[model samples]
Target chain A: MIEAIRECLGQEMDADSRVVVIGEDVGVLGGVFRATDGLQARFGKERVVDMPLAEGVIVGSGIGLAMSGLRPVIELQFLGFGHQAFHQIGQQVARLRYRSQGRHALPLVIRSPFGGGVRTPELHSDAFEAFYTHTPGLKVVAPATAYDAKGLLAAAMESDDPVLYLEPLKGYRLTKDEVPDERYTVPLGKLRVARAGTAVTLIAWSAAVNVAERAAEELSEQGISVEVLDLRSLNPLDIDGIAESVSKTGRVAILHEAPLTGGFGGELVATIQQECFYSLEAPIIRISAPDTPYPLGGVEDLYIPDVDRVVDEVAALAKASA
Target chain B: MSESRFLPNFESIAPFSRLTESGILDSGESPMSDEAVLEALRYMTLTRVFDDKATSMQRQGRFGTFSSVRGQEASVVGAASALDPAKDWIVPQYREFPALIRHGYPIENFALYFMGNPKGGTIPANVNMLPMQISLAAQIPQATGLAWGLKMQGSDGVAITFFGDGASSEGDFHESLNLAGIVKAPVIFFLQNNGWAISTPRENQTAARSFAERAIGYGVEGVIVDGNDLLAVHEVTARAVAKARAGDGPTLIESVTYRTGAHNTADDPTRYIDQQELEKWQQKDPVERIKNYLRSRGIWNETLEQEMLDSCAAQIDEAMEIARNTPLATSDALFDHVYAEPPQRMLDQKLDWANRNGGAR
Candidate 1:
């Protein structure tokens, strides 16, 4: 996934003279994760510039650059660090184009790695999609696979509206897939049914999709076929996709790496219930992190929801209804 | 021998004033032609008239809360005079009526904003002026970025952002200055030191004697000009813009001025300011000083003053009429601009509001 991000950024910068990369250590250092590696040397310092350690200025510069007919792909270092620049991203960048009544076209992509399970420092692995998803006029995309990573990054670069592109910290190098060399784009506001099933459906995105797929495999051994739904985009959430899956399977479980209370799962659960109230056989279940700050790096494996947690919860829902 | 007579040997800055308050010009070649002086003074007077009328309209509940540019006319106008609208960009804070008008923004745009219309921000493309930002110093970074973009495009254009004494205390100001310095961004940080952030005094904003002195630590040059002196403000800004376009990096300009009115319609300055201080600023009013200067040059008289006042009154009335004739916005107007394509949740909210409002939305 990390390679996919770097290669696509290279391709996009090569393709468009307007595409410029800006962030902390993005120039010579190529970012902490090397997501923008080797572009500065090829594109020159002005196009792939290293910014001062100021998140507000980074995002704020993105807005001005976008306004001046440039497509800026800004890296925020980490999702949790984005809170420091929330006013720029949330207030101005998200609302400027809309408030200008379509006069300002802000083609800015704010890319940040999110989620836990990798032993990283505090504030480096928080899943903060809910905050961006809740903002109007901003699109949020979370990719769970390398194929989607390259495709979504390309799509975000090509998008007219500002996109909050959230990459997974755990899946950056751990998760691998055969991404095409040629540029391709996956449309936003759509979901993919990774695997089809009959009894129950498990919904997740980003790194949590791994847990859902694994849990479905475990449940299949017991003859309880579980459908897996990957919500590729959070803002224009594919409501019809979730509704169709939930109606087919009578039960569901929502999973995410963010905290339990006020997490995105709550909105998904409510949405599914509203769409398929009569199809529900038992109370829906949610597998997520505890409502607490991200724990120490050593306890990350235990902190984030795992396959065991997903399998246990779905099995309990199945037994409860039967 | 015990107490040697010592005169102040430090180079004291005689505040750069080309036009004296008593209708006299100090010995030097004038920076402006007679027509330019008249044009500047007219712009200042028209801005003052607009502000006064806006205040009255707000008092009568015809407009939303309004901030008056009562005493900071020369600071805005003179800085605006330094820029060519074709090359330089103006990123302004909220109280920039004269600058916006000088940059080709219609006066009715401000009236539209005061009347609570979002269309007020939609300035024409050729003007090269950004919309007025209400968040203290947030536009500073954007200005730097725009300047950087211009430099990247190999254009000899500069971007200038306006803020006040209070905004100098914000983190945005410091961060923007730092970035502008590091990248050698072709930008100018124009600080209108109006002595108050609502009620906070300039002395309380910083302990560093003057705001311009901080430029040393930020790796940028800075200048201090008499904000009420139009010639001084225009000259200093022109120099700064020249250096920025020449690739000498950013500049911090501290324009010392005063705010003579209440912060906004919602607050009264009498509760927080000393009456004697208000009297002192009123004496140095930028418009009166320029009018005196023009009068000293044999270009201003009773007939011109009368004609100018009458023309300004009619222009303001026309602008207000435009704002007044604009129909009130409905709840659907809120949903219309939220996104290019309304998300499902936004659509649902709009539908729900329409249902509750008897299809009014």
Candidate 2:
């Protein structure tokens, strides 16, 4: 996924002179994750510039660059670190176009990696997509696969509105898939059906998609065919796709690594009930981490919802509906 | 009690000034031409007139809550006049109607903004200015970025951002200055030390002797100007703009001024401000000081003042009429401009909203 992201960035920078990459350690250092490796050398220091450690300035300055006819792709290092820049991301970046009544086209992308199971430090693996998804005028996308990562990033850079492109931290090196060499975009606000089934549906995104796919395989052995839907975008949610899947299966389990209270899962559950109320044969179950801060590495496995948790919940939903 | 070793001795920096409080030239000849000074006086008068009318309209329920540019006209107009609207850009805080007007923003648009119309926020394509940023110090880094972009485009234009003494305390201010200093962005950090941020005084805002001195820590040139003296403000800003355009990097200009009026229409200055202090600031009113200077030079008189007042009132009336007659945006307008292409869910929600509100408008 990291190489794919770097390739897509190079392709875009090659295509557009206005596409500038700015972040802490993005220039000579090639970024902490090497997602921007060789960009500064190829594109020159002016295009791929290293920024100060301040997160607020990174995103805030990007807003100005975008306003001045430059497509700025800012890296926030980690999603947890974005809290320092929430004012810029949420208040200024999200509302600039709306507040300006569309006169200002902020063609900007804020990329960050998040989610647990990588044994990272505290605040390094939190899934805080809900904070951005709740902000109006922002398109929130979380790509679960390497192909989607490159495609979604391309689409985000091409977008006139600001986009929050969240990459799953664990999937950066672990997840692998065949991504096309040539440039292509996976349109945002759509869900990818990772697996097909009939008895039950599993809704997930980012790293959770891996867990959902694995759980589907386990459920299939027990004769409970499971459908796994990977929501690529969160803000402009794939509501139509979700409704279609829920109506087909009649049983659903929404999963995420974020805490239970006020997590994006609650929004998905509400949306499902609203759109597929009559089709639902059983109550929608929400599988999530507890309503506590992301703990240290020792208990992170217990904190994150694993394949066992998803499989158990899907099997219960299938049996209850049957 | 002994002084802590951490406390270091600092030198007191004097604010740059060209005119006395009595409107007499205190330094060398003014840098402004007679024609330019007259133009500045006209814009300052117009700003005062517009501000008064907007405040009155707000009280009469005709306009939205407004922040008046009452005593900060010289600081606002002086710095704004230094920019070339064709190339330079102004990223303004809320209290910059005078500057926006000087930069060629229409009076009708300003009136529309005070009337709570979103269209007012949209600047014409030709005008190189961002919308008024209500968030404190948020536009500082944006100004730096805009300046950097201009430099990258090989343009000689500079970007100037405005903020208050209160905003000087925000993290964005420090972060933006540090970044601009490192990159040598062609930008100007215009800080208006207006003595108060609502109820908090300038003393509470910072322990430093002057906000300008903070620039030394960022490796950026810093200057302090007597904001009430239009000549000093204009001279200091012009020098900074020239330096920025010449690729000498960013400059932090701390314009020392005061906000003699309420912070906004909803605020009551009587609550926290001392009457004696307000009275003293009133003596150094920027509008009166400029008017006095113009009169001393035989460029201004009672007849000229009446004509200016009449012209300003006529313009204000016309703009207010246009703003009053402008139709409000429809329900679907809310769904528009969020993205280049509205998502299916947004479209559905818009349809639902229209249906709920008795069909489309």
Candidate 3:
């Protein structure tokens, strides 16, 4: 995924000189996530700038740069630190296109590591995609593997809207797969299925995709058929894929780490119930974080929906059908 | 022509002064256009009447709690009128009724906001203004960014942002100023120093003598002006806005005004502030000073003043009726604009909620 992001940056800068990058340690240290590693040496500091340790300044400047006919890709060092610049992201960048009567384009992308399981300290492991998704005129995407990361990064850069490109820290280096080095763009709303199954559909995105696949394997051993669907995009969600999967399986389980009350899970469950109301053998279930602030330390695992939770739901569904 | 006949260069005027309290434009300044002076007074009166009526409605439970721009109308209207309306943009904090109204926002829009509708107060897409923001200092960087966008579009338009004295304490304000200066973006930071932010006094807000001085550190010119003097405020703002539109970079304007009312109907200034301060400011009310000046110029009369008051009251009454008659926002709009194409999740939630709540069926 890191290599894919770097490759996209290289391709985008090569195509458009107006595409510049700015973030902390992005130039010399190659970013704390290594997504911009070596872009500074290749694109030069003028293009791949290393800004101060101020999130507000970084995002505020991106707005200025984007307004100046330049496409600036910004990296927030961590998803938690983005709280510092929520005003710029939520109030300014998100509304610039609509507020200006489509005369202005905030052609900017904010990329950062999000979600838990890396054992980072307080504020470092946050699932903030839901927050960005809640905002208008902003696109939020979380790629679980290399292909979506690279394709989505290219897609985000070429677009004229602001995008929150969330890189799941747990899936960043641990899960690597083949990705085309050439320039290829993935449409914002398209979803890709990581693995296919027939009995019950397992819907997930970002780090949850990995857990879904693991649950699919465990459910297969228990003579339970499970289909794993990876939701590559969040904001412009691939509803077609969701409907198609639910139509075949007749059962759905939505998964996410954010608290369940206003989580994307509720929305997904609602969508399945609406689209395939007659096809259901059981009510659609959601395996999500309990409605609480994400707990830390020994309780972090409990805060996130895992493979065991996914398997348990699958078992109950399979038994009900039998 | 005597030296007094020449327009007084705002560059020489004291930032906060009371020369205009006697109800006369100094004879030294160039004779101003009679029409321009009347227009300024007209808008100022309208703003004052509108504020009073809106508050009364809130008290009567006709509208929700509202932020009143009572004493600071002259500063807001003067500065807004000074700009080229077609080319400039406005980013307003909650308490900018005078500026918003002058820029073509109807009083019904305030009703829309108070009625809990997002689309209610939404500035028309074609208008050069943004919706009023309630979050402290959140709109500063946005104005800076919008101005920068305007510069990139090759238009020499400037964007002005309004905030209260308390908002100056937010980090976004400082960050926005630094970026605007560094990029030389055409934007103006208009700070209304209205003495108190709810219960907190100006002395406790910041140690910096004047908020405008902070711009100096950002490599831009900063000025302090008596916000109550409509002519002085207009002249100072006109010059600063011209400089910005000409690509001379941003300016920080500190308008030293007094809030004659509570921050809103929700607040009670009598609790923390001295009653003496309120009485003292009544001696220098912005609208009364302008009216006194116009009467002295022989352009205004007792009969004309009474007629204008009656007309202003009638206009407010009409606006109140329109605001009250406006329909409440429907719940469907909440799901409608979240995205150009909402995800299935949104559609599902809308359907589920609708089916259960009876909106879907």
> Top TM-score: which candidate number?
2
> lDDT by residue for model 1 over A129-154, one digit each (tens)?
99887788899999999999999999
Per-candidate clashes, comma-separated: 0, 0, 3
The number of the candidate with the highest DockQ is 2
Model 1 clash tally? 0
Model 2 chain A: worst 10 consecutive residues (lDDT sum) = A313-322
How accurately is candidate 3 docked according to DockQ? Answer: 0.25
- DockQ, every prediction: 0.55, 0.75, 0.25
Worst 10 residues of 3 chain A by lDDT: A96-105
Per-residue accuracy of model 3 over B1-361 as CA lDDT, tens digit each: 5566653232443585434786777756622366876777777777778777778777887767888778887788778878776778888898877677777777666666775655565565455776677778877876886787677667888889899899999998888888778768888899999998899999988877678877877788888988888877887788888998888999989998999888888988878988898888878888888778777778888887778778888877887787777766455645555444445666777788766665673
| TM-scores, one per candidate | 0.96, 0.97, 0.80
CA lDDT of each prediction against the hidden true structure? 0.86, 0.90, 0.80
Error of 3 at B17 (Å): 4.4
Candidate 2 error regions (>4 Å):
B1-10, B356-358
Q: Write the per-residue lDDT of candidate 2 for residues B1-361, one digit (tens) a residue.
A: 4865763376687889888888888747888987898888888888888888888889899899889988899999899879899899999999998788778777788778777777877788788888899889999989988898888878899999999999999999999999999988999999999999998999999889999989989999999999998999999999999999999999999999999899999999899999998999999999899888888898889999999999988988898888888887567767766777677778888888888876975
Candidate 2 vs candidate 3: the DockQ winner is 2
TM-score of the second chain for every model: 0.92, 0.96, 0.92
Q: Give stretches of model 3 more than 4 Å off.
A: A6-52, A57-73, A87-108, A116-122, A130-139, A154-162, A170-190, A198-203, A207-226, A236-322, B1-18, B24-32, B115-119, B295-298, B303-325, B345-361
Instruction: List candidate 1 stretches off by more than 4 Å.
Output: B1-15, B351-361
In terms of TM-score, how similar is model 2 to the real structure?
Answer: 0.97
Would you list the rank order by lDDT, best first? 2, 1, 3
Q: What TM-score, to 2 decimal places, does chain A of model 1 have?
A: 0.98
In order, the interface RMSDs are: 1.8, 1.2, 4.2
